[model samples]
Target: MSQHAVLDNNTHRDLRVRIEPNADLGDAIMSCVTVPAEFRQVQAHFPILFHKNQANGAFNAIALFGFENGENLFLEGGKWDALYRPLALSIQPFLIGRSADGDGPGQVHIDMDHARTGDANGVRLFDEGGQATPYLEDIASRLGLLDAGYRASEAFFAALRQHELLEPLTLEIELDDGAKRSLVGFHIIDEERLRALDAATLGELHEAGYLMPIFMALASLSHITELVARKNRREAHG
Candidate 1:
């Protein structure tokens, strides 16, 4: 796809704002003069606040977007954070932006708490609290597992194994106490793949104890590909 088309495609799939790169930071600040109706709707639901300051004939604006009650994850929070964390840690001078003027530049900043306090330099895109949504927490709790750090797939697999789900070809996942229920598919790990994993890796999984099964299941299902890819990319560059 052409560059514009590719960007357009991504914009559709994700929540983003474009600002002119060349424009004075002040001009960029003013450019958000009108909040798009869709954004206003989002503002109504979540805390999307902007502060603009005038100095040296230039404007400095900081926009704070908050996710409340788990709704904003799709727009610009936890989901994006989960997807980008591994990649961000590897890349330096990493920033996301856009330009107000088409020919100018724009930027999107991913801010994370871990990035702050010198834990990491990049902007944090996800809230740690939101990372453990009740639905996911329930999944873990029922299976007697803990979060494998902030990685969702790892946490999921940990829950699975803790609950001894490996032998079951298929199982009923009760999402809630009500009538809601869904069937979860399962796959058996082949000996080749199992054997390929070294002792240290196996030990790490075992160390996770109840969490090990969940990570194994996630690995088998390929749910951790993005996280693993990001981790590999970071290692390559580091």
Candidate 2:
């Protein structure tokens, strides 16, 4: 269970958040959420794809960590090897809360049960004078970015659906030990359909700032091979 409360100086004066380096620190089950706003950066390191939420039938973009569940191949020696880290993972133990009006600016809330949160030792949430610390400010900023990025992604994903550009992907990967892995049930942009889009449609997507992310997502597919290699390395070293 999570104990979330709107962060304030009065209640959480002595609160401290530990920044741990363990791969399992974050809820990274081989895939982590990635917003369209960071697709350009996420693409360079991880393969970007869309996952379907079974309950709501909604799609969410994700940066894959490994071919199998609970396997984060990017983790080595308690460090992430990738050049880019997903914002979703970085904003740990903190989540954006809904406004009182159900819109406008969000409230910053913390998961008190998270292993990183405690009053003992770490970055303090507030100074003795009741002002936000640099650490808290940074968390708020990143949390805001994540909220905005998620909103922006809704329209971008809708555009992809409207143009019939999203396609199911199934990867057949071979391991270093001659074992084969089948990865399925994820979605990626269809390059052929994207190329076949009319010039007018392309212009509209470009004007809406969705073109760059689309291309970036398409480019990120190449990183699947890198994921395979990383898995193989883990298999060999473990």
The C-alpha TM-scores of every prediction are 0.18, 0.94
Deviation of model 2 at 200, angstroms: 0.4
Error of 1 at 205 (Å): 14
lDDT of 2 at 30: 89
Candidate 2 lDDT over residue span 107-200, tens digit each: 9999998877884767898999889999899989899889999988888888988998888998898898999999888999999999999999
Question: Quick one: how many clashes does candidate 1 have?
Answer: 32
Leading candidate by TM-score: 2
Which tens-of-lDDT digit does each residue in 125-190 have in candidate 1?
233532433432332332221111222333434433444333323323222223332222223333
Task: Give the winner by lDDT.
Answer: 2
